[model samples]
Target: ELERMNQEINRIGVNINQITHNNNSALYSREDKHRLYVFLKQIKTLVSQVQERL
Candidate 1:
């Protein structure tokens, strides 16, 4: 179970890295910012779920 959580976290990290890279290569817009915020919220929820399980 711990290993699964670790894998999930790593996947989120990769997604974040990709998003950051894209943001770096482009200009920030309201939509992109909002999308990033939503994505981060999802990550936060997943983390909370993992914590609860542990």
Candidate 2:
């Protein structure tokens, strides 16, 4: 169970990283800038979830 949790944490971390990377891209205010904000928020949420679960 611990190992499974570890793997899940790692996977969520990777996903959060990817979202951060995408969110870190150059600005685009004219387009869907909200997407970046949403992604970053999701990253924060996921990180919190991982921390709580761990």
Candidate 3:
């Protein structure tokens, strides 16, 4: 009985680790996307300014 309980505990620990890893990856991806969006916006603004000057 004790062995079975230990096995279950180990399995739960592994599942938690996997979930944490997936969450971190998702957060990193979201941050990267946000940064890219901001960079594109800046480029668009610069282009508009240059167009106005011309």
Specify the highest-TM-score model's number. Answer: 1
Q: What TM-score would candidate 1 get against the native?
A: 0.70
Write the number of the candidate with greater lDDT, choosing between 2 and 3: 2
TM-score of each model, paired residue for residue:
0.70, 0.49, 0.47
Off by over 4 Å in 1: none
- lDDT rank order: 1, 2, 3
lDDT of 3 by residue, 1-54 (tens): 656655755675575567557666775477766775575577567556755755
lDDT of 3 at 17: 69
RMSD after Cα superposition, model 2 = 3.8
lDDT of each: 0.87, 0.69, 0.62
Expressed as tens digits, the lDDT of each residue in 1-54 for candidate 1 is: 799779979998998888888888886687988989997998899799888988
The TM-score-based order of candidates, best leading, equals: 1, 2, 3
Residue-level lDDT tens digits of model 2 in 1-54: 778867876887787677556657753463556776676688678768867876
Candidate 2 residue-wise lDDT at 13: 74
Model 1 collision count:
0
Weakest 10 consecutive residues of candidate 2 by summed lDDT: 23-32
Question: Per-residue error at 14 for model 3, in Å?
Answer: 0.5
Q: How badly does each model clash, as a count of residue pairs?
A: 0, 0, 0
